[model samples]
Target: MARVKQKGGLIGCGFFAHNHLHAWQEIEGAEIVALCDRDEKRLKEAGEKFGIANLYTDAAKMLASEKLDFVDIATTVATHRPLVELAAKAGVAVICQKPFAETLSDAQAMVDACKTADVPLMVHENFRWQSPIRAVRAVLDAGTLGDIFWGRVSFRSAYDVFSGQPYLATEERFIIQDLGIHILDIARFLFGDVAQLSATTRRVNPAIRGEDVATILLDHETGATSICDCSYATQQPEELFPQTLVEIDGSKGTLRLGANYQMIVHADGQTQTLDVSPKLHAWARRPWHNIQESVFNIERHWTDCLNSGHEPETSGADNLKTMALVFAAYESAAADQKAIDVRRMA
Candidate 1:
């Protein structure tokens, strides 16, 4: 097969856009051709920093005029559907940021639009791509743990996410929607589809309207049970471990992902810690460098999928299950810890 030189167009120039731009530039067989944002200042800044000459304040205008192979939608959750629909209609493949849409209906529409257009759509759910978590997944798949029965994927910290993205604090969905969605998706990725979910939510922080903390119980289709918990209230040394750690207990052994990218596997009376961090790139900056790396990993996967004609690990169709899990968590929490079947929402 000939190597496909895929051109990229980025939508929504925000804090996350710089990371995407840097990653796209570093990846082979991909080039960012243009950037679009409703804010002219942000658009211009990103365009100037990334050396992208073509810029647009309107996505539709950019989609119509630009000759691009794929579009990266880094905008907020509310804007994802329309932009993805536009990109799909324009015959352009799409890589969208997480929480694919505010509602399952909108998410389904986005997926259906891409299918109708015969274009590929991938959700940028990067948690599963994180190196330490990926290593944990590898260990489980290798059967070192053997027939895992229970697990926990937790994220809790006082990171002040509201200061950077204040909209998160005021949203009706709260931390579960913002942070729990990623953790839920990670559980779905590591385990199989969730059969049922029961959850409890709390607004520990007085300032937020939605629950800042949630604990969810997941019944996997494989008879493995898991807990997915998330919070913006808990304080940690670095705030990194609050959510990314994974603990799994299998019939043969146990596995744990600790803070600072440590993966410990214990089986057959033997224990080992895996050195998981790969070399960091020059542009990868602080606070959440691991997260930045994961974003790059997902971007590279997207580029490879476009080049090799394969579906990405985080394909639109696959992400529907993840999104359904998110909604199921909310429904479970709202109903006072009632077990909610995931398929009911579908």
Candidate 2:
């Protein structure tokens, strides 16, 4: 039997969208048949580079003309809700990029739209899909580290991200909104849903308009407390750019995911060290490869879910919790680091 590929259309040809485009090419059960971007130059360039023929400057025209099974929305936060709603209105499934909406109400509206349209909607929150992160998750699932009680998810680097995405430097909410969202999602992925959250932020980079550093404290529903901290201002001897380091302490023992993808687990009176690294795909580069591979992983998961009629692990409904944590962090920071009830916000 031949596998029928799901037809996909990609919107927003931007810096990070290229990774989505490249990863879609490698996906087994999906193909990006049409491209849409308001910028004609970027749309044409992406179509030429990827050998896509169907191109459009308007998304509605593309959605109405093409019989797409799903739309991969790689647009910025400002456009996510509209694009997702458009796709849902067309009865097409949607896989939108992270920071899925500007607010919880908007996120819920998008989710409701898809639900009413009977279409699957997934948020492309891919950090938890990284191979190294999955490895740590596997350990937890296998009961290797029993009864997780405490953890820390940290991503500290002095990398020059502005060189690639200059707009990030100008966002009113930088680290927590752009970077810490992923770290916070990972905390939820590893520990569980958050019940309470408190945070503090700092503007280390005077040139930027938003905070470049943030630390968040999460009280998980499972009674596990965790910290998610992200910084682009730290000048360290070893720069672990794009790498997420983790520490997990459980009833039996502890686990540490250090730099260079090193994961150490100690349990039952024994310590085990493992190398957990992401695969470098043909179209991926170093440092960014971890994230690139996760793009592939999550997209592959989308295709599988579409085929199997399974709800994605990071569906819009699920992402609301993560987004709640993001907003709650900001609220906490603004309120003098006071704890905010995450469930109420979500």
Candidate 3:
């Protein structure tokens, strides 16, 4: 028997919500039937652009009226807890943007809400879903990398992101909350959860309210060490704006993922290089295609899991570990590079 399309409503039609909407359009078994936002102008624009007529300026009204199977919350951190709880109370699944909450407590509340309601919740943590990153994970899982001991996940670029999301520059917590969260999650995906970690942060860009650069050292529970770093102040001739370069050293050999989605794996006395760049979807643009494709992939995974009675890879409960790392990085940075146990989020 063919299943009916799962009706989904999207909340917050801001900057990155367009990517979610575009990706949702490509996902099978899912249809965004409604839109919600406080900004009337943005709501009208997105409704017309996406051809979604069921729109609301208030989420409560939309939740009360729309019979949605899921709601994708693309709003900012400040609105995350309430929106997630609202969806949970309405008995709809939720997919929320990263930096899931401003604090660990708020993140916990949102996760708890979905658990209590017996609904699925996925954090929009899409970095690990990026194809190139998945390729590296495949090699590691195949034992081709052989007992990984050390690794580095880095994303450094000077792209003018503030032009689109101007509020990032004014946030008390910037890079770690904004960009480093992805890098840290990737480290967890490639390696494992952290036992302890320390970090150092810098505000190289005078214009931003928070630190624009950060370097973190993580001790994975699998007896591996990894470095996760991010910067918006880096300047290079070849600006790899959106690419995350990776290097991992294992008992057998080393693996390197460089610019242009090139991967070199040297193992078993042999070396091989492969191009792992993501395919550009019809609606996706370059540099962002990798990210956009991951959005589609994860969303499809969400619907599949929702149907199969399986939990998503980045489920709210699972993302709690990733969320802990984000908070630990900040605590370490503020404590003058003191090592912090990942278990103690405070």
Candidate 4:
């Protein structure tokens, strides 16, 4: 018997949604049958570019009418709850963009709605799905690095992000909510669930409304400690816009992922360097290729999980833990570097 293709509808056709559209085009078992965006001009532009004729201005209208297996909500954080609830009521799976919610209560409600509907819910957090990060996890799993004790996941760039997403500059919270979510998730992915967290933040870029710098310390349940730091104010001779540099120390060895996708593992007096760069898909451009590839990887993961009836790695339930860290970091920073117990957030 041949496998069935899952027909999905995409909402919010602005900026980053383009990547989602392109990624869905290449996914084998999925097809985007409909698109909905509040902005008529953007909807028309994206519909024309992707040759998608099924477009709507209202998401409720799309869900009420289209026979969809899933709905991908690419809208901003404020709209997540209502859109997710709408999808849940429609009995369709949902994949939401991160940061998942403005508040933990909303996050819990969205998760509960999906649970009540018995439909899959995934947050489109693509950082860990980045090939280099996957390679790092492979190294850890293979025991080449032995029992991992400490790690650092860092993303610092002075690249002009506001040029594309101008709205980001005006948001109340910047790096942590936007970029740090991914880095913190990477820390969780490598080090395990966090038991406690401490953080500090500062707004270095006067041009933006939120902090451009954040440093968070995580004490993992696995008895490992890790640091997740991000800065949009750091400038270097070579700009690593979308690169996430990682360093890990273990019982037996150490691992380092440097700029230009160079990954190195050192153990037992031996060292290996490999290029873990992401492949440039036909529609992908430079600098953004890594993130673009991850968009594709995560969408494929969603389809595979949807088809197999398996929970996604970043499922709504699992993302709650990651989402906790995000809230904890901000709370910690606000309380003057107080250590926060992750459990107390609920």
lDDT tens per residue, model 2, 175-274? 9999999999999999999999899999988999999999999999999999999999999999889999999999988999999999999999999999
* Per-residue C-alpha lDDT of model 4 across residues 99-172, encoded as one tens digit per residue: 99999999999999999999999999999999999999999999998888999999999999999999889999
TM-score of 2: 0.99
Candidate 3, lDDT over the whole model: 0.93
Pairs that collide, model 3: none
Q: What is the lDDT of residue 60 in candidate 1?
A: 90
CA RMSD per model (angstroms): 1.5, 0.7, 1.0, 0.8
Query: Model 3, poorest ten-residue lDDT window?
Result: 337-346
TM-score of 1: 0.97
Instruction: Give the alpha carbon lDDT tens digit for every residue of 114-220 in model 1.
Output: 99999999999998988778888889889999898999999878877787788887888888777888899899889888889999999888998888889999999
Model 1 C-alpha lDDT versus the unseen true structure: 0.87
TM-score of 3: 0.98
Instruction: Give the alpha-carbon lDDT of every model.
Output: 0.87, 0.95, 0.93, 0.95
Task: Please state the error at residue 31 of candidate 3 in Å.
Answer: 0.3
Score residue 200 of candidate 4 by CA lDDT.
Answer: 100
Residue 188 in candidate 2 has what lDDT?
A: 95
